[model samples]
Target chain A: MIDFIFHFTMIAAMIIFGLIAIEHKNLIYSAISLAVMSVFLGIIYFILNAPYVAVFQLVIYAGAVTVLFLAAISLVTKAKGEEED
Target chain B: MLPLNLLWWYLGAAAALYVIGLYALVSTRNMIKTVIAIEILIDGAHLNFIAFAATPTAGIDPIAHSIVITSIIIGGCIAAIALSLAINAYKHYGTIDIKKLRRLRE
Candidate 1:
């Protein structure tokens, strides 16, 4: 029961954040949401007993990839002189 | 015990994510949003792969782990490259909206 609840919660959180990441009007907000989703997924990976995979996901997705998205957004955010998202 | 609802839960999540990602891809006009949608789609596929590879008696599959790792690497590279291209597009077009880039598309 605990395992099922844990997985179910994490998956639901991931899906919710993922939708916000893609559908949100603000780019920076979307990027942050993506990071949140990735972290939730990493927890799910850990729960699934793929500890190495979970670690890699946290290092890669939440760490490196989110940094990449933020960098690109910072560059482009000012390109148009529009309000920061 | 584990085979009963666990399998369907993962499977259902995979399906829902895939559909949501596809919908985002079709509905979104921003290049960045499209890229995010693609990431979500890949994640959905990864979930399906992991779910199917996991067995109640045997445990998680090593092969699936390897594959998911590679996929994660590739997805990161693809997202980085695509974001750069979007940046360049924004520089030229002043917007990342796909509909405005008619010359490049045709």
Candidate 2:
């Protein structure tokens, strides 16, 4: 029962965060939401008993991918004065 | 094997993810949002793969797990490339909105 509860909760959170990631108007906020959703996805993998996949999901999606998105957002949105840098 | 009930639950969640991602892809005009929609779609497929691999009769299939890992790596690469392209597009067009970009092109 506890496992079921945890599984269901994580799955629900993943879906909610995914929606927020795509629907949020601000690009930075959308990237953060994607990271949060990825975290929940890692937890889901753990629940499914794929520890290795969970670790990859956390490290790649939550860590590397989020950083990449944030970097892209910052690069693309810099002020006019900062564009020369 | 995972209980039939649990399997159904996981499958349903995967389907929901697919639908959400598809809706976002179709409705969103922002380049970054389109990339995000793609990530969500890939994640949905990963969930489907993992859900099916959860059979108890045999421990989690090593082959399937490896495939999922490979897919994850590929998905990361795709996101990086797509974001780079989006950044380049923004540099050239001064906006990330696809509609604006189309107008600028014409």
Candidate 3:
């Protein structure tokens, strides 16, 4: 029962955040939502007993990937008075 | 192997993710959003892989975990390259809209 609840919650969160990430107008908000989704994905991985994979998801996807998105957003948005698309 | 009910549950989640990702990819015109859609698609695949790796007798398979890790790294690299390309395109064209790159074809 507990496992089922955990799975349901994580999957729901992943889906919701994923939609927010893709559909959000602001790139920063989208990127942050993606990070949140990644974190939930890592939790799901951990529940599935893939600890190493979970760590990598948290570190690579949630941490490094989000940072990359933020950097790119800032660079592009700030360049030559380029506005957000 | 996971029970039939559990297997379907996992598969359903994965499929939902796939659909969401594909919808975003097809509908969005922004370059960054396209990249994000790709990431979501990869994640859906990863979830499928993990779901199938679960076995009643042996627990989670180690090979599947390794595959997912490798995939995550590759996805990151792909995102970085794509973002850099998008940035370069923005620098040159002053716009991130995919529809505005007609000069590239000409």
Candidate 4:
């Protein structure tokens, strides 16, 4: 069935991206990978017929949480000369 | 006929994710990675909840869905507060390395 195929593919992708987020050295890359994994998870939710959960996952997680992560990364990794601003 | 064993797919994936998240939490040195791992662990648990609620014969449970919705809001709050705490820790220590964070030694 089409649903089965889609579900399997997304699940595989999710596993890889999640692992990459955990194993990456750079914090920013890890955050980016986490966002990608979240998107895949959202799609899985959609496929599983939980539209509300999927939408919230994309909006709250892929949007707000990733932004929060980048903001924290930015604050912590500030350049020396840019401190005046 | 669709195989009845399909539920195992979701459950297996959830178990694998939880294990990976636990490994990340234990092995990673960075605070941000730890936070991400925690999020992953919560997501795995969320998947398990939904998987059970989604069974065809058992019928969808609105109650489980409502609980998951609340958990999402709470998880978001936890992530925000944890990241802010990490920011403060970075400011105080100049680095997030846990090994260098011993204040009582100095």
Which candidate has the highest lDDT of all? 2
lDDT of model 2 at position B78: 98
Judged by DockQ cut-offs, is candidate 2 incorrect, acceptable, medium or high? medium
User: Candidate 2 chain A: minimum summed lDDT over ten consecutive residues — where?
Assistant: A76-85
TM-score of chain B as predicted in candidate 4: 0.89
TM-score of chain B for predicted candidate 1: 0.89
* Residue B88 of model 3, lDDT score: 96
True contacts kept of each: 0.51, 0.72, 0.65, 0.44
| DockQ measured for candidate 2 | 0.51
Residues B71-94 of candidate 3: C-alpha lDDT, one tens digit per residue: 999999999999999899889987
lDDT of 1 by residue, B9-95 (tens): 888888888888899989987788888888888888877777766757656689998999899889888899999998999898777
lDDT of 2 by residue, B1-106 (tens): 5776898898989998899899998998888889999999999999998998996655679788899999999999999999999999989987788888899889
Q: What C-alpha lDDT does candidate 1 achieve relative to the native structure?
A: 0.81
User: Candidate 2 residues A37-73, lDDT tens each?
Assistant: 9999999898888999999999999999999999998
lDDT of each prediction vs. the true structure? 0.81, 0.89, 0.87, 0.81
For each of the candidates, the C-alpha root-mean-square deviation to the true structure, in angstroms, is 2.4, 3.6, 2.2, 3.9
Give candidate 2's error at residue A10 in angstroms: 0.7
Runs in model 3 with CA error above 4 Å? Answer: A78-85, B1-3, B57-59
